[model samples]
Every structure is written in structure tokens, then in C-alpha cells.
Target: MTQVATTDRALPFDVEAVRADFPVLDQQIHGKPLVYLDSAASAQRPVAVLDAMDRYYRNNHANVHRGVHTLSQRATDDYEGARQRIAQYINARSACEIIFTRGTTEAINLVANSYARPQLGNTSEIVITQLEHHSNIVPWQLVAAQTGASIRVLPINDRGELEIDQFEGLLNDRTCIVAVNHISNALGTINPVNDIVRIAHQHGVPVLLDGAQAMPHTAVDVQALDCDFFAFSGHKVFGPTGIGVLYGKENLLEQMPPWQGGGEMILSVTFENSTYAGLPHKFEAGTPAIAEAVGLGAAIDYIVALDIERIAAYEQQLLDYATERLATIDGIRFIGTAREKASVVSFTLEGIHPHDIGTIVDSEGVAIRTGHHCAMPVMDFFGVPATARASLAFYNNRDDIDRLVDALHKTKQVFG
Candidate 1:
């Protein structure tokens, strides 16, 4: 956001240098060099993030914001310092807008209950797109079920891109909120959130963006997008798991009730009623993920140091190369071919199950995610059970894609 680290003085992306930071990428799998292509699922963290978490565990293992001891202070600082770093990274108006959660799933769920449920009525509608991951889809379903509101889905074209022409028609007086993914994890289709937000706001409706896939790939300025709520996970961005962020506009967050109740979320607890804390802390329920938060901060540091512009360019090259090479393979029907996309490639082979493709690739030490990619609706639209997805990261090189190609050849041979 504010800190995109895209200065012209930044150095070119040294692929080897970036690769060296992730020690897990150096190892072998199934007696072959590992070619990790599953970043869309969970990215491998660099040593900086790992070390940061390790340092916190070793030197500052204590409950945060509840004690006067030195360790407690250290832990609290580390945890809150992470919030500040994340806020700065995403260019939030204030650190108070960032709420920590288990992951994007919990983050979206928090808004579903706290923000949407109370506002929705029998005649209300929640608009989401077909490109959404299940995390984005199911939360709205639950809230709509509770409030007797209906869920309206914006359809996607054959290329897996949202049919932008239809977006305006979907929003009416009954539409309360529009939730869509910034980038589809399954299809890598980058949705036009600017248009989505502008049109939704014109109808006096708020928009929430599922930004899990977009956070790692691009510079995200929430203020620039002007979305009401944005959710993303740290694990998808080379940070530790079990830590994520929900960024809401200050005015909207102030009006919403706390989704969960417990210590730290409350200012005072008594027999009469418990008073809630303000801003971010009100949503963070219990002893938060301190080490993970610190690791997430370090992950942001690592990404910043490398410069996001270089990373995006390098990854685009990888995607282009992989797409060209994979197109050479026979019966390789691309599931999603959006003009604007991230590094993800989802495809299906003729008469070959995605699981079989994944299995054969694993034997070659090429790891890819093979499933509906948490977007079964996407699969249903394409009339496929699942797809083999090779998602690229900045650390990935041409050799990784080559290995995947060789593995796919083997899969085809085995199937034939």
C-alpha cells in the first residue's frame, strides 16, 4: 500500500538470491529436486520470517497486553508492532483498522456476522462473484441464511473473468453488500475491483474484497481501491500460518458489533454487561498469535526489501513462459485464460483426473495443487471435477516450470 517498495533505484530480481532465503526450496522430494508450484495454497516462508518467529518464541514468550513484566512488554510490542507494520504496508488510514484473525476465512466470517448480519433483512441481498473461493462464498451464505436475505452471484465468462457488463445489473436497492475476490486463487483472474467498488458505492452498497491471492502479487492500496472491507491471509504471502488481517473502513468498523467476545476484546466485564474495546482489539478475541504476527511483520520486511515491482515483473515472465510451454502439451485444456491474470495456471488433461496428474508430478518432485482450488463453483461452471494448478512465486525459476512440463508429459504417457 503506502510502502510498495517500487523505487526505480531497486535492483533487478536475483532469482538465486531470493531462492537462497527459502531453505525449504533447496531440498529434494521423492529423490528428485523439488519444484514447488503450489504457492497459491501456501507459500514457503523465507529464513527472515522463520527466524523472527523463532526469536520471539525464544526471547519473548509471554501473553501480550496483560502483564507488567519485561517479557510481556516485549511480546506485546512485537505483536502490536506487527499490526503497525501491516497497517503501513497496506496503507490503512490507521493501525486501528487492521484486525488480526486465524486467517482470511475467519476474517471474512467476522465481517459476515458483525457487519452484514445486523444490516441484512428479509428483502436484502448479498452479491458475490463465481470467482470467489469457498471462504468468501460460504460466509455470506451463512449470514444470508440467518437474515432471510438472498445471495446473488455475478457470472464469469469462459475465461474465468467476471462479466463486468453484468455487474451493474446485479446491484439493486436490495443489495446490501458486494463481496468478491481481488484475484481468483483457482483461475488467477484479477477482478476489476475499482469498477466493482465504484458501481456498488453508487448504489449505496458497501464492498468487501477477498484479497488473499492479490496481496502477494501486487501493490495493494485499500484507499486506492476504496473498498469497505479487505481480507487476506499471511500464509499466502510467505508469512506464518494462523495469522491474517481484516481491514475495514474506520466508520464502518466503529458501527459494527464485535463478532467474538472474550478477554482482550472487552474493556470491562461484569454481571450487568461487558464493555468492548475500541477498533482492532474488539475483533481480536483471545491471546492472539504473537509469534505469527511478528513473523508476518518480518515477511512484509522481506517482501519490501526485494521490491514488489521486480517481483511482479519476474512472476509475470514465469507465468508467460509456463503458459507458452504448457500450451505445447497435447490435450492441455486451460481452465482459465483471463487476459489479466496472476501466475496461476489451472488446466485439465484429456481423460486424466487432476489427482492422477498431481500424483505423477509428485513422483517427479513437482508439487502442484490439484482440486477445485476451494472454488467448486468455478469447477462446476467449467464442467470439470477439478484442475491441476501450477502457481508461480517470485522464488520460482524456469527450471521449475520445465520440471512440471516433464512431469505432465509423464502423466500423459501413463494415462495413454
Candidate 2:
């Protein structure tokens, strides 16, 4: 993969001013200022997103594509407009390539069932990495089971980065598709997706990226990566729950059959004979998440107004600072120290269960995630049941990291 050189400079936006945009951040938890650091799970939505959804429901609420009334046209415009904005945000070839789903999990399941299931057989295999979230892993497992095919795993190293050598060896003629996460949600390692896509394409296989974590921290150009499919959740990117995107290459989508048969997805239907709609609407069935799509559009607009590159740089600095400060605490073991990462730090303190660490930190009003992080294989790789994860977003600053460190120290004191 070719590396692009960029200048290292401070983020341009005033983080405090940006923090004011999120009303939830200006509150107290346990009588202390709420220090939210678990953005990898779900980010706090700004007022723009909230207001967009509110506006959509209050004024333009209607089912899309079917009604001929004024409200229907307005709602349809907002929904389709959101699709276009998302396509531009990701540099997709056209808005038609985007398919709306419940979230990343459903998007992956769509590909697994619609595209891969019919193509795979007893001789075929599916390739994934050990670093994948449960959402990315489970769908393929179900596909393999139904088809009598096998599943192959690309292992990760001690640093939680994929072993590329093993990955190359695993890709063979029997490999039907390659599915992996763009970023490890459990460890924050940024996978080399461009390289992964190139390697898979060489063997006549397509790749699908689970971008739920990566989308919020960095810009994703699906065209540049050349991946066949990409999936991400709106909530993870500061949009709304129950809405996400699945972007597929137009040619591939044309070849794949619709996973669900319902209202808007079809052009005409009788008892036995049915015809499907074109491009995007073929995959997007039913009434769809109208307000959530509008909310996602507002979130995209918010992110674009504050440049994505600037957000990436700011979050990197937060990760570096937090890593440095947390390293000073005694007996704190870092779970993932990848050369390339996003805004997440997973660690475990000496002689303390991760749940205990989480509970103690919560008492001090610091929010962090403590569990297997929906990647139990990752936990097993590090030989721990779970780790305490503190993820960052652009809204976070040096003070949030300091408070987290102080809380960790307090946890140590409580345990002692």
C-alpha cells in the first residue's frame, strides 16, 4: 500500500466550542463532570443530528417512493438526499451503490446471505480475520454452515495486527469472499485495507470491510480502497441508531439478488412473478428508517464542515497523550500497541478484574467500556477475559484523558 505523507499540526477547531454542540456532554455523573471516552461503542450525537430528525418527523413525515402527496415528496427528497450526501462523503462512484440497513450487522448479513450464499458450495470457503467483531464473524459462520462450506481465519499477531503473510496463504481459489474489519474495535488497530483488497482481487475474490469503528475516526473512500463492499453504522459515526450504510460496487450489486422481498424493493409483483427495482432501491426494502437517514445526513454535514482529516489528527493526538499518561500508572498493561491505530486504548491493571476497574472508574464519573467488546476471540488472543477500553472522539480533550488517568489511579487505591 502506498502511504500518503501529511503534515502534523494541531486541530483547527476549538474543542470546547465543539463540545458545547453536544448538550449531553455538559452534564454531571456521580456529582463529577461526565468524561465520556467510549466512542467506539457509540458516539454522542450533536444537536444538528437531533434537530434534523426532529424536523423530519414533525414536518416531512411520510413513506418514501410510493405516495404522490406533498409530504411524501418532501420526505422522499430528504431520504434520497441523505443517500447522495453519504455517497459523496465516502467517494462512492454513485449514490445508487449505497443501500440502507438497520446497522453494520444487518449489512454484513445481507452480503453473506444475498451475495455469498448462492455462490458458495461444499468446495468453497470464506476468509475472515481473528480481529473481526462478532457482527463480521457470525454472518459468515452461518453462511458456511448452510452451504456446507468451511470458514478460514487469518490470525493476528501479539500487537493485534493481522498477520499478512498468513492472510496471503489463506486466500485460494476456494475462497468465495474475504470479510474483515477496517479497524479492530477491541484493540484500535487500523488494518491495511487497501493492501487486503488488492491481495483478494488478485485471486478473483471480493472483499467486504466492516467500517463501523473506522468511519468515525478517518475518511473512507470506497473507490480508492476498491473494496467490493463496505458497511458502517450511523450511531458509531455520531448519527442515529437503527440506520447504517452498505456500499457495494454497482457491477457486483447488479449480479447479486435481493436479500429481502418487500414493498419498495420491487417494481411489480404478483403471486408467482415479481420484478425488482433498480440499483439501490432493490436492496432497500420496506418503509425504511426515514428520520434516521435524515439524522445521518446531518451527522455527515457536521463532520464535513469540520474536516475529517482534522478530526483524525486530533483523535490521534488524544490516543498518544492518553497512552503516555496511562503508561505512568503501575501495573497497567496495554492490550494493543499497534504502529497504526485509531482513538482507542485497552488495558488491564494488576490484580483487578476489568469489571471492577470499570465500576470504580464509573464512580469517578469516567465512562469506559469493560467487557469482551463483542470480540471474544480478541480477548482470548490477549489471554484475558476482558479489558477496560477508553475510546476517544474529537469532542474529547486533554482534560478527559487526565480525568480517566485519575480514575484509574483511584481504582488502584480502592483495590489496594
Candidate 3:
């Protein structure tokens, strides 16, 4: 319930005050002040999130849902309270719609195994975009491999935006589901999800949004978008890793079977047959990441107190500045230049591998993610081996971008 300092929402957001909350950002790395900009991979957790997890373990540590003891009740309260916070974070219809998973990977896999597996037949198809992370893509491929269903990809244009014009042509009576990322992690393109959902719904196909990158950067309301399923990871939103949410429409969840079988998911078991539990618990089986869930709840509280719309605006400003600053570097080519973007910049310097760029930048205490970004298809389409990415957060300042630019200059100097 700690607020991340109200910095007069009218002004450009106070980035320093926001940075102060993340103690990990305070220290120097390799004798230079750290300019940690790799937020798209995983955001730094605030002290608020840290303390929340610590307090949960210290005071209310117990097995959830089964025990009738005092600690169990409190643990259950904390665990389920976290679920409520997640529901509120995304404006889900009910708390029951929120199911806990290890991360976005598990959440998508859960939907694939539980929902998509049974629904998809030999002739059925699953529609996805070229912009999907490996988490989003691999699950459907596994589903396709298991079921006789086929996978169709919606192509991205040269600008790295989803080609919405060609989207409808890929859909037909055989389409089972359309899963796309809310924001491309590799490109930072904000996909037009409302339009995607609307078009998919027209074909009577449900849609799932991979929202791991989107939840941290934008305001998401499941009801407003009317997406059938949404998945995101806690670590991407300044929460602890190994905890995430899967939000599904109530009616659909009621129809889908359990993805995993174990302790919490079962109602009763006879030798012959076993009955399943209801709604979310039906999906969340075994001992969940209880402390991580508490941390995620605290992270949501922190993000909410700061306000997401204002966060988005401030981060947009940072993105603009970073883009302009990086473009000044000689021999640099930008990737994924969509008009709509989050605070992530993906690019490469001429004749310099991204790994070398990352290593050189790290020595100067500037951190940036460099790889295919788990979107190998994206890399393939762009005809590049990999990209160097500087993903930002609200906590980042212009100084971080400046340091990154300086480090890249040094990289070029070394190459020269």
C-alpha cells in the first residue's frame, strides 16, 4: 500500500523520485554509475515489492487453500488478495478469472493445453502474428504438433507493424484462435488489439493477447478490449520472477478443462475417476509461488499509485529522446520503426555484432538487451542475425540514454 511519491501529475513526471524507489539502481557497476535500461526483459523490483514478499514470508507463511489453521488462513488471504490485485490491475471481470502461473510462458501453455488442445481438430487452425515471442509461438507449435491443427501467421510489414489488411484473409471457419502480442517485445510496436479482437470475433474465433510487455507500459482493460485471454509476467512489471497471471473470460474458462492435475485442482478423487475444481484453481495446481504473488500484488499497488497513463506518457517521452539520440550514431540502423511504440528501441550498428555492442556497453555500466529477443522469426524477416535493444521504463532518465550513446561511441571507436 506504499505510494511511489506523487510528483504533481501535471508536470513532466519526476524520474529521479521514481528511480529512488529501486535501490538496485543506486550502486555503480564496473566502477561507473549504472544505467540499467533492459526493462523489456525484466524490470527492476522496487523496495515496496521486496518488503511485501519479505513480510509475507515472515508473518503469514503457510500452505494456501487446504489448511484451516491461523497461518494458512492468513496465507490464503494474502495469496487470494494478490489475485484480486491482479484482477484490478487489468480490470478483469472477476477475481475468479485470474489464474496464477510461473510466468507468461506457463500462462500461454496453460491456455494451449487446456483450451486450444481440445477445441482444435485436424482441420482447425491457430492464427498468430510474426511478432510473437517464443513463449507465444512455441506453445501453439506444441499444440499444433499434438493436435492435427495447423498454424498460420499474420505477417508484419516492413515498418514492423502487423499487416491488418491481410489479417482477415488468414481467417475462416477452420480458425480456432488468434493469439498476438499486445506490444512487440522485439519491435516495441503497439499492435492494434482492439481491431484484432473485433475481427477475430467476427469470425467466431476467440483471441488471446500476450501482454507481458504491454502490462508494464500501458493501461489494459480486458473488458474494453474484449479479449478472450490475456497473459503477462510479474517480473516485467517490477514484481518478482516466477509469478504471472492468465485472465480468461468466465464463460470460456467454464468450458476449458484443467491444464495441470494435482493438489489444488482436484475436488475429490475416487479410484476410478477424479473431479476437477472450479474457475482459476482449476488451472493453478500444486504449491504456487506464494511469496512472488504477494510481491506482484505490491508491484501492482506501486504501479497504480504512480498511475499508468502518466507512466505511459513519460516513457513515451523517454523513447523519443532515446530514439533521437541513438540515431545520431554513425553506421546505426534502427529496426521496428512503427509509428506507435513503447519505450523500447531495437537497432544495430553497421559491422558490429549485437553481442559485442552489449559487452562494450556493459563495461561502461550501460545495460541493454542484445539478441534475437526470442523473436527469431522477426530477426529472420528483417534479415538480421540479431539486434541491440535499449528498453526503457518510467524510472529511466535522459542521462541513461546519454550514457548508452556514449558507450556506443566508444564501441565504434574500438571497432575503428
Candidate 4:
């Protein structure tokens, strides 16, 4: 770990040293120094993650699990090594519980098709919260349509937080699964997942958490949360894209059938008899994302070195600073005001479209996310078409927030 000079900053961690690790942040955007604030969508990667992927492709690029040569063995080791690191990162019981997919969307869809679909009957119900991203919601909807099952949505309060009481009432004997986001990508509301899991367990329901937005900011212990299944994306964790993880309990994975049937997932194949492989591989079909997995492992290493607890505390400070600064602007209404949140600030500027805000900000070399943020239902609940979202990460500093506020003022000026 590279150690830099310790300064008298609000955070104990060295933000300057951390920012130095991200090479992309060094460049200018639109002839101005870039201030990236859209980490919830996808975070910028560190040099370590980039180097790991490059090393894998250059030295250990080969198909895994069926290798006879030296390259094959190395590739298999690196790939499975990534899985082990991921398992440890999330505190999974074993590496066999970590199934790789394209991203979180595919992970949720796998559970929807294999686990939920088989158990669901005509009268069965799948319960999900309004805070879920489209990835979590659409899959269950598709499975429900196929199996003649019904979908039930747990409501959220005006503050954009999940209604725990409503969620408890929605779970019944007929409920097949309870799916929700660990943190809202659009709102930054941290759901009470521990309570969710405990309540669902009482009704004999399994809970699946979409941890895509949560992985980058906070520490997640699957064992501690006691969720039946958890899904997260690699790209959001400062890793390369196209690789993600789906963790399932040992017993549940053994019973669930494979969602896709292709190369790596099967043990023995025949015209009449095709037996599937065990736990993790049973779900991971076709050629896996080898280089991306190595990058994800490197990303995990970076986070472990930094210490997630410290990162979370520092980011909360950033969120607070940004919120306080942005609040001074007139006609600025915050979208999510949950007592508990991560490093996301979403709001609407009166008499201005979010798209225009995003466009104007980009000109000033300040990046922000604009739109319904793939949670259109949240937009409907707030009665707004879209919002301007500035999400932070460990790398972001006070300067980034200042630039964003200045850019918003410019947007207001232009719109007027």
C-alpha cells in the first residue's frame, strides 16, 4: 500500500493519495479539469485494476476448467482466485457460492428464472420494494408472467425509504421470494436489509438484495445480512465491466436448476442424459469473463487495503458537504432525504429540465447523472420526470462538489 503524507483533514484516510491511483481522473474534459460525480452509475477504475486485467490478457489468456497446457492452468487459477477473493470480500461460506454473470441484472434474472420460477405457482407471489432498480423488478415480472405467479410491490415513504411495516405485511405463506435493493441507486436510501431478511425468514421467504450501488461505498457481509441471495456488479466497484457476482446459500444453489445450458455448466452431456455441474459452475454457463474477473479481484484488493469502514465514513462527510452547499440554491428540491444514506445527492432545479442541467454541467467539465436513473417508478412517486444526481465515491473531494454547484449555477443562468 502506498502511503502519502497525513494532513489535518476531516477524514483519516488520505483522499489525495487515493485519487492519485485513478489515472483517468488526471485528464481534462471539455478543456476543463473533470469533476466526476456519477459513481452510482459506474465508478472509475484505479490503475491497479487496469494493470491486473492487462497482465491477465497478456500472460494468462486462455479458457478455464478444461486446460491441459500451462496457460490454461494459470488462467484457471487466476479466475478461481478472483472467486475466492470475492467470497472473502462478502464473507460468503465458500467460493462455490459465488456465481459470475455479466452484471447484477443477469444475476437477478438467474434467480428469477431458476430459483423463483420453479417454486412459484399460480397463487404464489414475489414481493419487491419500490426502491429496486429496473434490473430487480423486470426479471420477477418476466418470471411471474411465465409461471402465472403474481408480483407484489412493497411501498416506500415520502422520504424514499422503504416502508418496513408494509414489507412485513406483504410477506405471507404464498410469497415465493422477497427481492429488494440494498441501497437505492437513484435515492441513496440505505434499506434495512437485516430487518428485511429476519421478517422474510419468519414467513419462510428468501430475500434477494441488489447490492450494485452499495458495493462501492460500504462493506457488505452476506453472512451477517443472512440474505438467501445477494447480487452486485463489478463495474460499480471500480472494476472492469461485464463481470458481476451472484451469491446463494449452499443448500439453495444445489436445488436450483441451471438458467442457461451450455459449455461450462454441465458435467456430462448426452442426447438423452445431460447432468449439470455442482454449485457455482452450474449457474455460470458458456465462456466466463476471465480478464474482467481478474480486474474485479484487483478492485477488491484495493478496497480491502483502504478499509471499507473508513471509506464509508469519509463518503458520508462528502455527501453532507454537497447537500449543505446545494441547499443554498433557490428552488432546489432534494429527491431523497432519508435519515440514513450513502454518497448520492439527487435534486431538481425549478423551471429547468434535468437533461438541460446535465448538458450544461458537461460543458463545465462536471459529470452528473440525469434521467429517471432506471427507477422510473421512483420518479413517478416523486412526481418528477427526472432529477440531476451527483453521486460521490472515496476518490471524490470537496473540490468536486464545489465544481458541481458552480456548474448548476451556470445551468440556472442559461435556462433563465
Tens digits of per-residue lDDT, candidate 3, 63-83, equal 999999999999999999999
- Count residue pairs with overlapping backbones in model 4: 0
Task: Give candidate 2 misplaced runs (Cα > 4 Å).
Answer: 1-11
Q: Which candidate is the best by lDDT?
A: 3
**What C-alpha lDDT values do all the predictions have?**
0.92, 0.93, 0.94, 0.92
Of the pair 1 and 3, which is ahead by TM-score? 3
Backbone collisions counted per model: 0, 0, 0, 0
**Structural RMSD, model 3:** 1.0
Worst 10 residues of 1 by lDDT: 1-10
TM-score of the candidate numbered 1? 0.97
Query: Which residue pairs show backbone clashes in model 2?
Result: none
User: 1-416, model 2: which lDDT tens digit per residue?
Assistant: 11111223453656887788888999999999999998999999988898889889999999998889999999999999999999999999999999999999999999999999999999999999999999999999999999998999999999999998787899889999999999999999999999999999999999999999989999999999999999999999999999999999999999999999889999899998999999999998889999999999889888887778888988888899999999999999999999999999999999999999999999999999999999999999999999999999999999999999999999999999
Model 3 lDDT-worst window of ten: 1-10
- As a TM-score, model 4 comes out at 0.97
lDDT of 1 by residue, 219-323 (tens): 899999999999999999999999999999999999999988898999999999999999889988899999999999999888888777778999999999999
Off by over 4 Å in 1: 1-10
